[model samples]
Target: MPELIFRQPDGSTQLVSAENGSSVMQAAIRANVRGIEAECGGACACATCHVYIAPSDLLLIPAAKEEEEDMLDGVCAERREGSRLACQITVTDALGDMIIDIPDRQY
Candidate 1:
């Protein structure tokens, strides 16, 4: 299992554990992490599961594909350099510990 550190909009943090090969969105949902709404489940259709990757850990995963990029454009929060949809990130040992930043709102 890998650990994910989610930094909430209020500057608070929630730690969620992830199973290898499972998506980050799944871990957050299972752990009941407040910021990952995942309204579209893991289908990559909705940007409700948007999360900002810590720059330091950005290299651990591949960049967003075209479909995910399209959805991200509609996120209610401002999109930044490290923006990503949690549903697209699969937990792996190489990711070790991921620090994600949750935007202020998903709706």
Candidate 2:
């Protein structure tokens, strides 16, 4: 398992263990983390799992594909350079202790 640190907009952090090969959204959902809805069930079909990659951990994750990029644009919160679809990030040792910030909303 890998560790995931989720940052809330108010500056608090929630740590959760992420199962290997599961998407970040799945990890959050399983942990009952409040920010990730994963409405599309890791299919990249929706933007409900939108998140912002912490710059320090950005390179540790994979680049987003075109479909994910398009989906991200629909995220309810304002987007940033680090915006990504959490459903696309599969956990791995390389992503250990990976940190991400949840947007204000997922709709």
TM-score of each: 0.95, 0.94
Q: Write the per-residue lDDT of candidate 1 for residues 3-104, one digit (tens) a residue.
A: 888889888988787899999899899999997899888999989999999777888998899999999999999999899999999999887667889999
The per-prediction CA RMSD against the true structure, in angstroms, equals: 0.9, 1.0
Highest TM-score among the candidates is held by which one?
Answer: 1
Local distance difference test, per candidate? Answer: 0.89, 0.87
Off by over 4 Å in 2: none
Candidate whose lDDT is highest: 1
**Candidate 2 residue-wise lDDT, 1-107, digit = tens:** 78999988888899999889988899899988888888778888989999999777778887889999889777899999899988898899888877789999886
As for candidate 1, its clashing pairs are none
